[model samples]
Target: MQSCRNCPCTSRSRARTATARTQRSSRSCVTSTRAGSSYRWTILAAGVVAQASFSAILLGLPAIAPQIRHGYGLTLTQVGVVLAALNVGLFVTLLPWGIVADRIGERAVLATGLTGCAAALVVAGFTSSFGGLVAALAAAGALGGGTQSASGRAVMSWFGPEERGLALGIRQTAVPLGGAIAAGALPALSAHISLRAAFFGLAAGCVAAAAIGTALLRSETTKADEHEDASPPLRNPRVWLLCAAGTFYVTTQISLIGFLVLFLHDDRGVSTAASAGVLAGTQVLGGAARIVVGRWSDRIRARIVPLRQLALALAVAAGASALLVHASLWLLVPALAVAGTLGLSWNGLSFTAAAEAAGRRRSGAAIGLQQTFLSGGGIVAPIAFAAIVHATSWRLGFALAAASPLFGYALLSPLAERRS
Candidate 1:
């Protein structure tokens, strides 16, 4: 107390304390920044795995349509019904799951849904009857629906707006990635072993994906700016328009993914394995296209413009594929590949648009709503395409399905104009 204020030792002590505090603060900041930067990528990886696992089941079943038809002694239309069952289940649950993801977070929802989906697929593998099979597939679809919204929401939360487009695009690749795997593997599994074996393989994928998600997925804490002036997702007109456009887009996707194998095999007389191989190739190309388009949107800083352009390209590609449906394999193969790749590419764009319109706070619900519309189309496209084919011809069904992207293009025009 006696002139300690002027003491050199006291001043030195204060300086050392300040230096130590600054060092600790700097270290903490570096640690936090590194964690934030690195973990988003981990979340992305987990999201991709979760999405791909479920997609293998959703899209894979259609790749082996002939086997499914032969196994169940069903006609083309019945196969459509069987394929639609999964969509029906997804249509019912996607919105609710989205809401749940917003409330409870992505990790719990993805883990629970994927685990349930795996169980349902296991039940599907055991079933021998058509009714039982449809029921099981539907159940799997219902449980698997969470991945659609949860993974998308996770991407939106973890990444900044500038990076979200590309991040989501990478996430969307899981669809084709899963489809490629299923198209290549499920058909072989069904043909070499049995249809049950294929179902079991999909179940194994779901189990692995669920484990990865549960282990790696963590909910990001809600940020204050995320909720400020945010519109309710359901009430947003832009969200609805995006959903409607996505519904139309799904028609093309389902046509390519759900029926490409059948068209190649039955119409072009390509062998099933060869047809599935074409589909697998299409999926690989589509996945690459998604990444490119996503990055393109990020560079251009306009999601809707790129989305509209892709829609027009898809329309043209689908029409070309239809025209070449019965052409020589040399011509038809590349046409179908281009069409299928275009058909599968637009989803990530629409998904990003919807989430952005609703704001991050409501991104889950917006994604859910968008997926619900897509699921509805997925349910109808197969049955309608089959019925059209049954009534007329494969060429006619392809022609009609080609028109869907045109409609999507028209619906997206206003949004693109506004964005520009």
Candidate 2:
């Protein structure tokens, strides 16, 4: 056989092989980059679904308060207690869950917690006594608390600073979206079948979300990096200030979300279905507003500035709703929708601020601490608002609720000025 080492044909064939290999390598690199870019969005979708699922239990339970009260033959105060039970559970567990997420991983925390929450909701569905129902719901809240920190930490790890605001905003929409789903479905389900059916429906959602989140979520950090030293969220005054602002903001949110249906139904004589429809509409609007505000924050490259502005707007809108309480249904509905949308819009900004303040490694803890304050507000708002309504009137109660966002705005001013 002739030696062909330097043959011209052989040279051409070798060159062809090299070019083909280069092309294949380039294609693989592009494919990898595309997959990485797209996968973050998939992670975001999973987080949204997981949060929304749990929110159904947290916020949705209040939507069917009438059924719960009637079924248990409870007073408004007792109804407030029942509604607050879930927040009490959340308050107890949020920090611990956050610490756990920072140590382990988002996937494990979200999957395990959501599963436990589903089981707890099932227990709630089956329980017949008032005390048993409260206990079951609180258990669900405690377990579901993991979703808040883990899902947020996942977003912070996966997305860069430039995109974090919009990403968190979209993620935050899960709250109103979940509430809307619950408000729209639970009342009708309870009215037609039973309140137990409502609880079962929420359980089904949690189970489905757990499965989806488990399949999609993963920790973006290495074991060592995840445990890296960062500013302690507890010691950070900025974080505490953010927490205080969030606490006040949530009171307004709960006042509208937890009681709007009741107010319209009892005070205005609107049918339960109609009142729930308004609430559902408000939630949808709020979700859309979050997306818009999030994008706006990204454009401005500032979170607290817009947050403070929105707080003022929320205060005004809420006050307007209070004033319009006895106005025509057409007038009152639109005003409440604006206020509710404003109330729901600021959360994503605060979430982004808290995570950035703590650095990515400790984002979970910061978010947890912030959410814990908000949960405390969630616990108190219903009871206080209910008491105010019981003692004086719904109009006065709503007027007072409007002041919460103003307090939040004031708390956020120093932060906003520093950012400016």
Candidate 3:
């Protein structure tokens, strides 16, 4: 009845009521995303833990190689085979894991994979037979391979383009950090306690990493932009080139990691504990190198150029280490340190270039593809280096391994002309 002139009270009341409703809706929609929202550092931490889980079995083996070999009476060739088995598992699973990460999301894939690895390692710890132990390790590698793609993908998604290189560099440090920890702990455990206990300790680490990954990993819900959505990373030629370079680089790196302790202890007559300590120091320096290179790449805004230079540097270092292997610790230590630093430092730079080239949406799949090549190299490097060592000497084997990075440097030099 009070339709027009007398409706001031009604209008004001409706306006106030609408304003209150808006405020309530806003509050209701404000979900606590702080915990779930992706931070560059948080993603980096998750990536490190996931990467560490993957490295523990492989990297730790070199530290405890003598104990395991003596315990099982395994030949150097057989030891090499066992090492290759883990890479075999990684090579088989990388691409599939990448596809899964692209489809189901990185969080689920990493959590599920790391959890499975924990179980596999537990089985490995209890197994008495060397064959059984190798099988379990291979299985664990397959299960844990998802982290390679999933963690990198998470970093690519969370960080901006300019910062991804440095972010990934920091994330990549987990691999060496894991190696350092394993180097420090595994040899002591295998020597003092038992091989089984060492494996169980590694299993426990994977379990903790899985729990952390599940809690911290965030899933991407928004659609990607045009570049990321248009072409699959596998279709990009840049990715293939990066993968090619990575394969050679990984070959050289795995050889150094796999055989450094043995070379030190056998050739230079260093104690096992001292040799493991040196390898651990190398991993620490390598980790530092990654961060420095990554930051430098960010500063220059060029990835491939630095990668080429690093490859060349690695070649020189490897060659020098080969020549200096039988020398005194004063010479050998610095040579190995330089070689390890340059050899292990290339991954972050190449990975950043590959991921950027693949675009964000397809980064998981691309990283998986590239990692497959790297894993393939890992499979071959150990066996090949062992065979060469058996046929000739550790010096010759390292000399030969140096050629790989030289080739990688040659292959990647052309990329410097193009944008990274």
Per-residue lDDT value at 264 in model 3: 81
TM-score ranking, high to low: 1, 2, 3
lDDT, residue 61, candidate 1 = 81
* Predicted structure with the largest lDDT when compared to the true one: 1
Give a tens-digit lDDT track for model 3, residues 67-99: 777778888988888878878889999999998
lDDT of 1 at 372: 97
Pitting candidate 1 against candidate 3, the one with the higher lDDT is 1
Q: What is the lDDT of candidate 1?
A: 0.88
Native-to-model Cα distance after best TM-score fit, residue 316 in candidate 3, in Å? 0.5
Q: Write the per-residue lDDT of candidate 2 for residues 217-312, one digit (tens) a residue.
A: 976643334455697899999999999999889899889878988888888998888888888888889988888998898888888899889888
Q: What residue pairs are clashing in model 2?
A: none
TM-score of each: 0.91, 0.90, 0.89
Return the lDDT, model 3, position 169.
93
After the best TM-score superposition of candidate 2, give how far the Cα of residue 415 lies from its true spot, in angstroms. Answer: 1.2
